[model samples]
Target: MTFSDVVEAVKSLSTDEKIEIQLLLQQYLREERREEIYQNFRAAQAELENGSLKFSSNIDELRKLIQE
Candidate 1:
């Protein structure tokens, strides 16, 4: 079904069902965010292993690194 159709169907749900859907959406968003973080961590690990990752303790150096 289309997004608008799904939205219209949700509008017909009872108040309790709407609340349940809100909770489910929250859980799904959290799981998605967690997976995104894990993927980024894996990419960073690969960069570190390949000697392509750079680290800095100075603000000016960080800005220069980002510009590159």
Candidate 2:
């Protein structure tokens, strides 16, 4: 089966079933986003430990770092 087939099957679902699927998809998306944020946090920690990460409070300094 392909994406179109899955879409067609969803189209055939009753209103309640469609609502349930939408809720489930929203939950799945939230979990995926949470995992992505966790991964990014871990990567940033590693970068900090390796002494490659930069931090600044001044806007001019931040702009120079970003340009590099």
Candidate 3:
């Protein structure tokens, strides 16, 4: 439930159990991060397809043009 409870429970497990739990947690975290990255990529792709993305060729040139 809480971090302290998790730690206490882990402390009671055998070495093999601890290792198995650690691996399972690591895999779960990896999958979560991968899904987050994929969602970001999909959103960017949609923005590009819908013409909602913009870019400037030259920062200095753009600034000069804007100042005029």
Candidate 4:
């Protein structure tokens, strides 16, 4: 079914069912975010290994890098 159909179906759920669905959706979102973070860390690690990642020691250095 389409998103609209899913929305309508969820709207017809009982209060307890809605709460359970909300909790499940929240958990799914959290897991998605964690996976995204893990993927980013892996990319950063690869960049570091290839000597492509830049590190700044202080605010001035960070600003200089951003300006470039």
Q: Say which candidate scores most in TM-score.
A: 1
RMSD of each: 0.7, 1.0, 5.1, 1.5
Evaluate all candidate structures by whole-model CA lDDT and list the values in order: 0.99, 0.99, 0.91, 0.97
Per-residue lDDT tens digits of candidate 1, residues 1-68? 99999999999999999999999999999999999999999999999999999999999999999999
* Per-residue C-alpha lDDT of model 2 across residues 1-68, encoded as one tens digit per residue: 99999999999999999999999999999999999999999999998999989999999999999999
Off by over 4 Å in 2: none
Tens digits of per-residue lDDT for model 4, 1-68 = 99999999999999999999999999999999999999999999999999988997899999988898
TM-score ranking, high to low: 1, 2, 4, 3
Measured on C-alpha atoms, candidate 4 has an lDDT of 0.97
lDDT of 1: 0.99
Query: For residue 63, what is the lDDT in candidate 4?
Result: 95
Clashing pairs in 3: none
Looking at candidate 1, the ten consecutive residues that score lowest on lDDT are 56-65
lDDT of 3 by residue, 1-68 (tens): 99999999999999999999999999999999999999999998998999975557999877865776
Q: What count of clashes does model 4 give?
A: 0
**TM-score for model 4?**
0.86
